[model samples]
Target: MLKLENITKRYELKKKTVYAVNNVNMTFHKGEFVSILGLSGSGKTTLVSQLGGLDQPSEGRIIVNGVDTSSFKQQDWNNYRKNNIGFVFQDFHLIAHLTAKENIEIALSLSGLTPKEKSDRAEELLALMGITEQRDQLPKQLSGGQKQRVAIARALSNKPDIILADEPTGALDPDTSVQIMEILQALAENGHLVIMVTHNKYLARDYSTRIVALESGKIISNEEVRPSKQYKDDQLSTDKSSLQFFTAVKIAMNNLKIRKKSTIFSMVSLIPSMVLIFGIMNLIFNMSGYKADFKPLLGDVLGKDNLLYVTPFEDEQLESTQKTIYKEVNRLNVYNPRIEPFKNTIIEPYTDDAISDMEDIEGVDKVLRNTYFDVIIDEKPFLLMALPPKAYASYQYGVPKKHYPEDHEEGIIMSSEAAKVLLQDNHASVKHLVGTDITFNIYNYKSAAIKLPSIMEEKNVIHTKVIDIMDISTKTKLMSNYHAGYIYVSYGYAESLRERFDLDDFTLFSYSVPDPFKSVVGVEVEGGFLITGPQLVADPLRHLRIKTSLQEKYNLFQFREFDLNMRGNNYSVKHTVILNDAFNKDSLAKLKEYGHVTKSRFDAYSVESAKKTNEYINYSLLSATLIAVVVILIPTLLVCVILYVSIILRTKEIGILKSIGARNKDILNIFTMESGILALSSGIISLVVALPLIQYVRNILESEYDLQASLGSNPMDYNMLGIITAFILSVGIITMIGLLPGRKASKLQPNTLLKHE
Candidate 1:
């Protein structure tokens, strides 16, 4: 069943070629009990190793069942050892952790038997070896003879074609040695090709059917002592099977269970690395300000890139219209026409035709007009702004839901500062001022020169309720120069007021016509109508007093004199345009043709500034991540080196596993799984410990210093997906670190490893 043709195994030491087994030729058939006798360094064990496929011969070819093994691929050799041969050693190389029965079962795992069949087979082998009582005991708990018996059972478990025993009884007493020889003879009788290498000639002579003696590196003598016995029918063919993945994992798990302290220590060492990675991810998320609470502060007031503010520089038509209305109203015969034409003359209100023209502009989604006026609220001056319904609905943040005004509501939304002033108490909060009434005094400036009795009747005083309050502290541009505060009335309500107060009448005199030459009126002289030339010199002092008095009342009528140059045009000098798409260079240039354009939400500078800040933060975060990896690598490399040394220390165990049909990939996977488990355990523990601690620190800062130092306290708040990704990355790194040691252990030669042990 086996053939070795001129097989020679050589080794190189200091450039010297030493022949361990030189020019050897041997052949054996089934059912032959052969003993190879030689002194130390005489190549007895080397010959047996070459026969068992443990070490490849440097010269000559080994043939098994008519197939040459020298040309066999790696998998083929693994198969040859797993199915065709079994090995026993002087030290009885059974796994230290597994019980005797489990040790035998590991070999049976390579067979295609079911788990129950393997267990039953292991029990049968233990009974046959006369160690059934010791099947549950570990190798360390068994006697030296009992351990050898377990080793023999494990070797026979697979029902291999060849049994190679190198000094199987070398460490036993005389009685145990005799019993081990009888077991080998029994294997030979059962149709196995048993080849035993030993130094004792007495046992070889008594037990073997043939004896082969070696001197130096050649076979000096070969002869048969007695006739061979007939082979049994069950053991003629080789067992062809392989270790299953599940069985390999079971063995790996058992090995780890035996070394519990070492596994726990490895897991503990990974904690700091996990904490560092998780903490960095948390900081990056918080600094980006992408959390839920901060979304309101990002200013979605106009809805992304949809809104634009347009301001016009000049409009001649509006000026000409105002002048025509002034001249025509002066010819009318009326005490007070109630509504003045000049009041509606400012930037001629955009007509339907003009609005339609603007809507046709490329990229112009929608257009809305905004108007600001100075008004007296509770006797204090404040700026009042009118907004479209969309703009009103967009002001959700910092505005209470209970105070939100409907689209057609007549009530106004007051600024927090404006509410404080109207309530006459600086300490009043916005919530307490809701539903309060405030009187707004609106004056007509165009007809101020025309004075009459009951002039106060010309002034439009409306008592409006405060429906909502908005915090505008951070919006500096929106606040304007009104440090006293501001109020927001809907555009529809403000337009209704103009009609309700008869503000369009240019022929109406303010109760009485003013004597422009002598009367004192509160208005600014620079922009107001005055008699110049001879009229100024007629009463120079009186004119100067009149101008000063007019300047005082000038501000009261300031809202009317401002030219409404946008009249008869759909586009106002200052208007907001919502776009159909995000702003780009082409769209922005097109928008600039209509007016001075600015984004309603974010300015170009702010967006650019934010981008640069985020880039810097990302670069810094990458650097920190690299540093953290290096910090983790130092200990990880140390662990790998330590594991490498530990494998070197356990060389005997590795050899024993190889002898029992464990493949290189099997050994590699076992070690890698151990490392992966350790890394995953560490990551879970660190996340559990770090999240609550971070929350505690955040709470302390908030309570003690009124600081919003934390983005969130819950796991979901701090990027849970990122945490899981980090854990998987950590396990991969740890597995890579363990690969070197696992590879080293897998490549070790069983013959060389056993000699060291």
Candidate 2:
């Protein structure tokens, strides 16, 4: 069945040529127990290696079943070895992790047999070798004789036409050696061409049907002492086959199980890399630029871009409005947010036609009128906004819609800053102040009627309970840029307060009326006003005060002096023109025609400043991310080193797999799968450890520091997108790192690999 013609194996040693197997002729038929007898360096093993397709002959041709192998490619040789030839080594190079049955099954795993067929075939071979009971034992647990028997059984499991044994009895005791020889003799008798290379001539004479003696690299004598049966069966054809990915996975898992400590160490080394990546992702995701310096002046009631604040433009207050600059810094925000207050009280009222014209603007959604008044709660000043029901419904912020003021509910909703001041605890949660009573002292500028200053004193008191606190879940320009604290009261309540204190009728300053002087008895002076009214006598800072009576108790008169240029009524009723989502440029320009318009935070300078601040923050975060990458690389490099060393240590196992018909792809798959598992394990463990830490930090910030104080939005909020992205990145990086060593392992040659120590 096999023929070798003029085959000469040459080698170069110390720059000199040596012929290990000289050109010689050889032929062997099927079912012949051939024993190759040779001393050390006799090339008997080299000759057998060439016949088994483990290595090619350096000279001449090897023909099998009349088919010359001179042009056989690597794949062809692999197929030849897989389907027609089986190897039994002296040392029994079975994989250490696999049991005896598993060792046999690995060979058939490449044959495209179903899992049950492979198992049954392995069981039959074990029974034939008289080692059925030891099928479940690993090579390390089996005795020397049993290991050799398992090796023979694995070789015969594929039912190859030729069995090549290289010193099959070399490592066993005498009795075990004889038993192994008897098994080989039985294989040759059962239609397998058994070829064994041995140094023991006595065993060769007793069991081998043909004894071939080799001296140097040449075969000297070939004799047949016993009759051998001629082959009657057809030669086995080469079948295209490969190791399945799941089979490789099974083998890889077995390898990891056997090297438990190494696998554990590999997984441990990758955990820190995973944790660092996840931590950096969280930090990057939480950092924001808009919350630092620039704030949005308008809330989300109407889109910020569509909400227009229209300040009445009069010639007298032109310079004041020009000088009014919106401060970007939080501490400098204490100035009047309205830009210019009511002066000697000329309320340029919006006439019916003017209101209709504003409503007629192209994209106008609605025209909202609101009033601002000065108030003091617990001796702290606040700007109270009297809002209509529509405004209350629009500014829900974080509170539910149902929590806002109902039709006639007179309670006030305060901002977090106002709540803290009222409760006298900056760190306390505003939610606790809900449903608690609060007293506000309403004040107006009486003496400084024209120019509002610190001289304005308390006039009336309004007692109410806090209904809700603004939930600043998201930071806006209004929260960051508005100087005064905010408190919201229903429109009806504010009107009642105005009437109770005569805020709109003959008061010195009327924000809603064009001229209060027409109703009250007053005369314009050089720099002030002289007004006659019974209410004026209560003025504590009246420059000049007098009382007069025209009749009995009913007709009474009082006089109080006031400065004409004093910052006029510190309060002003204003209207906001809210537009639809599709508002155009013409709409804004038309609105600006009536008064000075408030610029949004997205204006040029504000956007530029925010960009610069965010760039700096981005750079700082990038530097931290680079450091984290370096830290992560340290462990990734360790993983690569460990896998490389693992490949080196398992070279022998790699050879055994190749000899058992495993392709390079199979070896690659095994290592690749191992790396994937390691990366997945590290990612899962790191996330488990990091989630609790993030939650703990969030709780501390929310409780002790009140996250809303510094950050408008909570940065510690959990982001599953960041976590999942980090995990995928970790696995991809580690898997790529592992492929380096896997490729090295796949390129190894089985011929030289088997002989490696």
Candidate 3:
């Protein structure tokens, strides 16, 4: 039972006054069939709407079963609407997209019913309303009378204690109106409190047990039209469904069937967020550049393909090593990685002022000079050196700086290895080399004397040129003899007659690869045995030890330039003797067993440059493509917001549903489900559209030059499919945005819906 006392409602908009409801008192008893009659603007709707808790009065007291409803908070009222009330509207506010059965399902779905329970219950309800055959039809497919029947069925879905009807016959013809009255009358006879709001006095008089007439926002009469008798309702036997929040959501989803146009519009709006996703992908891809391709960035970069390597050798085996080198070079199809000697023996000793007129070399791109051994000066070790201003390679191993220090022309760079060696001598390498003219003339041989510096930091004897400093990783495998370390200027400068005239040619290389173990497979047949086992087991250190032990018993240094040629099973190598005294045929025959030792660490170092650039470029290109793909999120986000707004406007229908007893979660699901459908469609379209675009991109980006880049997006990639699955997740996320407003609409109480008279 509900009772209202001194109810007052007002609207104040820009100082204008509105008496939507004013000082009204009314009492509604259980099992009482009543009609609220009034003219237009008589506050008929406002009064009933307040009773249902859709709105609170400006000043009033409302009692439900002896308790004032005004004391209930919004959440408490929400529970009240969910549990106790049922509503029907004359507009037949069935969700247009949902089938008749689905419309009823939205109301009953909150009861935690099973799918089977919902299906069976919905079907039963439809049968009770004589619309079972039309249960699958949408509202638009049904006649007005059929639609109204569906609305009434939906209202009773939750099996509430009372029924509220607002203008139950407003849009019906007289004959149909009478048929609707018969339904209301029948319900009243079954002991239901049928409270209806309508303007038709004749219809009220014909069916209602009591007529409560209202005029000018006040009750004019409360009279009994017919006395009620005790009645039993077999159709009212509703099973208590244990519906939960998720169930309510499912119901809301079913209701969203009405807004097809809105759904399509929402999907269309999400394009920008998709674009953003693609943009992020682009950024990641562009930043790294190409890495896996065979193309080189620059000549020195090897910038794309080719491999270079380096290793130091014992002074004794130079001739034997040279023979193996020719054999390996002839065997491999890649760039020739020639062995270079320490620049120290080549560039050192130019200390005395013995100079010849110099001329720049032609066809040579750049020259790198570095071959300084650790040596002592005044009981302290400072690196004595020459540094190159430029070098030739496809890719740069060292990261480049945008700007260089001004004093680099007068300064030299040092490595941690060099620094530690110098610190032991009680003098800092940088300070000792700065401000003071020092001697750079020291040979690797301990027997050589220290000569004064002929080349100054600011001036060169040949020609003056800007100087730049650089540091690099170094190894002393071959430079075992005592010598100072230096890393600048050209080999030509270091090799002038005034410098030490002893060093030969060789190449040295080192690299920090992503995974050396994983990449070992690419190394094919070498002058050494072709390694065909797991990479982790290959130990270069152990092999070096074996070679070292063999060197002590044999004359390795005597054959620095001897030719060693091997193909398949047979190989020939050369050995030059230091003196005829040790050059007996027997001594040479003793070294024949180690002929396979031609493959040396020097080979690996010589090819380091070419290999590093190839790997780097291929890796860079793949990274760019991935980054470009991920950037699509930007466009996806843009589209999501626009769709969200469209969803809010489409939810006006939620009001109609709430007045008909749908729960908050029920409405949430409707909007979420609707948006999910739209999102799914959009995602599918995007993937279909993006596939060809990505293929086109793959073709365009095939090479740094006009050479074709490969399309690497694998058609059978499960991981890619997994990424596409994320679109489903994104749909749910976007659905949440639309659900918020739908939930609010569903919570609107039928009793608060002040129906316009």
What C-alpha lDDT values do all the predictions have?
0.63, 0.67, 0.48
Candidate 3 lDDT over 265-303, as tens digits, reads 555666445433333333233322222111221232221
* Candidate 3, run of 10 with poorest lDDT: 561-570
What digit string (tens of lDDT, one per residue) describes model 1 on residues 1-757? 7878999989999999999888988888889999999889899988888887778899999988788787876556667777878888888888887899988888887777888999999999989989899888988899889998898888888778888999999999999999999999988988888999998999999989999999778999998988887653333244444667776667657766766887677666777766776665555444333322223323432235566665553334434544554564464422223323433433334555665666677777677655544355655545565655644455334444454555567977887777776777767877766687767754332222222211235445677887777765422111112233457777677666645443232212222223422332332132222211111111111211222232344321111112121122212234667777544667677657665565533333333433443344456557766775786686578669667876866788777767766678767776676566566677789888767765675566557543321211222235555556566666678767878888888888776777774
**TM-score, ranked from best to worst:** 1, 2, 3
Q: What TM value does model 1 have?
A: 0.63
lDDT-better candidate, 1 vs 3: 1
- Residue 30, model 1: Cα distance from true site in angstroms: 0.6
Better of 1 and 3 by TM-score: 1
RMSD (Cα, Å) for all candidates, in order, is 15.4, 14.6, 20.2
Per-residue lDDT tens digits for candidate 2, residues 1-757, read: 7888999889899999998899979888888999999889999988888888878878999988888999988778778887888999989998898899999998998898999999899999999888999988989999999999888888887788899999999999999999999988888888889999999999999999999989899989999979998886555467865887677888777777777898888777777667777766665555533323222222221236656655564323543543442131122322233423432233334554777888888998766544445555776556566665645466323444655666456878887766765667767887878899988765433321222211232445577888878754433321232322567776666656554543232223322223322232343443333333222222221211122121122221111111111221122223566778767888889987876555421222323333454455567568767876786688678878877888888998888878877777778888887777777777789889878887787788768755444444345667566667777877878877878898899888888889999
Regions of model 1 farther than 4 Å from truth: 230-250, 257-261, 282-593, 597-601, 616-620, 701-718
Clashes of each: 35, 9, 139
lDDT of model 1 at position 651: 84
